[model samples]
Target: MSIPVGDVTGVEFDRNTAFLRHTFLGLFFLLLSLVLTVGIVAAVYLGQVETRTDIAFAGFFGLFAVGGWNVTYGLLSRSNREVIDVYITTEERTHVLCGELADAEFVDACAELVDSDLPTTNRNPKLEAELE
Candidate 1:
């Protein structure tokens, strides 16, 4: 089930910008996350998480708070360059997903691929000039 790195042929992407705005729902998540983060911090400050189980619960709260924070950022950010998907096409004509890379670096590199080989000397995966 392994496609050698050298077998990659092309790259393609999918994007959805619906949540890339400061909408009411987005703001709600932002505010809710603040409360979650504060409660955990307060508990830690008061030494309420001394027990293993209490600490686990605190960690759980912190994880959700972080997830909410990330979603809020995505909603509030107006950057047009954010991409929702990027994947590669192997020489065997099968698609292989490439996780998100820094948008600018990925785009700039893709623009430069310009009909180059699968592994450019720098080994950047070739991507289409534009993400669709």
Candidate 2:
């Protein structure tokens, strides 16, 4: 089903109950990678790694370094815009991103039509026809 645009419940954004959670999982991942990279550097600097066998850490450090770069690039490239998530609640909930529909006003009219309690559509056919 299409996510109704505008406020289906006519509530202020601060009072809007639809946003159930805010995610920062990427931040956690980025921090974890950074910590690992720091640990590897410290081990080398503190003379904890000396033998030819310690050459393995060079590979580990390189892997984590690339992962951190990818995360940084993604964070830098993300757009600054309001996004709508259309979702279904279930044992494992589903989320669908609704992009660019912010410009669609017909969706708001449909939501208002469905929410109306009065017989405005039946009483005034012209307004109803225009909305449809």
Candidate 3:
């Protein structure tokens, strides 16, 4: 969607949300790996008989570490569509840098209105009733 170019005084944008799904998943995997490693080491130190379960868990931890590393990289390089480009101009010409959409021109006839600055007039009910 194309938004009319307006004279903006401020600009703020981000490439990613605070709670990125991949990032959280990566953290979960990495933490799960460390927990498994620690448990295996403690078991070995306590002279517990080595079981197939421990071996399986060690392999799972290794897989988690590898998967988590890849996920972290993917999350870092992901593009954010929610990012917005802000443009401000004091003259007839304006410049924009909205990824693919750039250099939007507007005729001088259309005056940009600031909705926030619109005046709100209070209506008197008695005055309206008398007129009716």
Candidate 4:
């Protein structure tokens, strides 16, 4: 299937690897909390402790904290910003496109005004004539 081209000038791409942290950390903490809750409840049940309300309340709060952590971690780790790979066009010159024009402009101003001395790599299809 072909990807649809939109009115966007250039598409930025960033992988969703950030979610992996959430998955691993979330599961680990969730399991840990579950085990602890089970142990606590078992102890309370077997010990003939009269503090049934306290044990129940503590277990409920613990589960809520664990569940909340998992949800928040997953959401916060999700990448909202996409990184630009390159500017796609038929233009001859490198456009040096940037998301923040002011930031680029400020850096450009402070940069030494000198022509690039990069040797044209022969592998570049568009610069074949220039390379030759």
Candidate 5:
């Protein structure tokens, strides 16, 4: 649906939740890998188990390295922010607005604005009939 330009409302920028979640996951993986590598090294040094071949050590080290890289890149390059465009649906079309704001605040504001602008209506009978 298209909205008229005059019907457009405020725009807000919100935090990119996906980016934050992924970043957290990356850090968790990095820490987990480091602990595993350390535990393996400690086990070998303490004679808790028989010394394995170099391949085992290499594999553990590889996992740790990859995790570290992922966390580093995520922190250095990615910002946890995204643009959210808000629009009002008018008789003619929908008008879109975009700007930067806190994610929670933007959502609350958008919900309030949309609720005020639009009326609650019943479901479409044609669509409901198709479902059956």
Candidate 6:
């Protein structure tokens, strides 16, 4: 018979992953903007171009503004997010599932089912050998 195993819920997993991804993207854009700005300044100082300086400056400022916004938004939203991992167990094996933590009934059901089946025996030979 199939039965719900349990649910694991927290913001840490999703939050950290999202935070890192956003942070990396934001930093990358910021670095790109800095490089472009420096390049434009150097070119203008060397008198290499006269008409394109305005366009370059606009692009540089746009990147800086957008990147800064993204970094701030990502950091702020990180703590407010959450993720849930659910598991179901059967006589043969355990299966992983996912859902929102707001489903309290589901979480309770799964936790109870798993708790009732506590101290499960390891049937896999590899795992058994490892235990030995």
Which number leads on TM-score? 1
- Model 2 CA deviation exceeding 4 Å by range: 1-23, 75-77, 80-99, 105-132
Q: Candidate 6: which stretches are off by over 4 Å?
A: 1-51, 74-79, 87-95, 118-132
User: Cα lDDT of all candidates, in order?
Assistant: 0.64, 0.48, 0.41, 0.42, 0.51, 0.47
Candidate 1 residues 54-79, lDDT tens each? 99999999999999999888777764
Runs in model 1 with CA error above 4 Å? 1-22, 79-132
Tens digits of lDDT, candidate 6, 1-132: 344334422111111122223555656666665666677567667876656767676566667756766665665455433234443444655566554444566446434434453443332333222222
Root-mean-square deviation of candidate 5: 10.2
- How does model 6 fare in lDDT? 0.47
lDDT of model 6, residue 60: 69
Instruction: Check candidate 4 and list the clashing pairs.
Output: none
Predict model 2's lDDT versus the native: 0.48
lDDT by residue for model 4 over 72-105, one digit each (tens)? 5665466443222223222233333323222454
User: What is the RMSD of candidate 6?
Assistant: 9.7
**RMSD to truth, every model:** 10.1, 11.1, 14.7, 13.8, 10.2, 9.7
Residue-level lDDT for 8 in candidate 1: 72
TM-scores, all candidates, are 0.45, 0.44, 0.30, 0.32, 0.37, 0.37
Best by lDDT: 1
Off by over 4 Å in 3: 1-30, 40-49, 73-132
Clashes of each: 0, 0, 0, 0, 7, 0
What digit string (tens of lDDT, one per residue) describes model 5 on residues 1-132?
444445544322222234333566666666766776677577767776654665576566767766676665676467665444444445555455553435566456555653554442213332222112
Error of 6 at 111 (Å): 1.0
Candidate 5: TM-score? 0.37
Instruction: Show the lowest summed lDDT stretch of 10 residues, model 3.
Output: 106-115
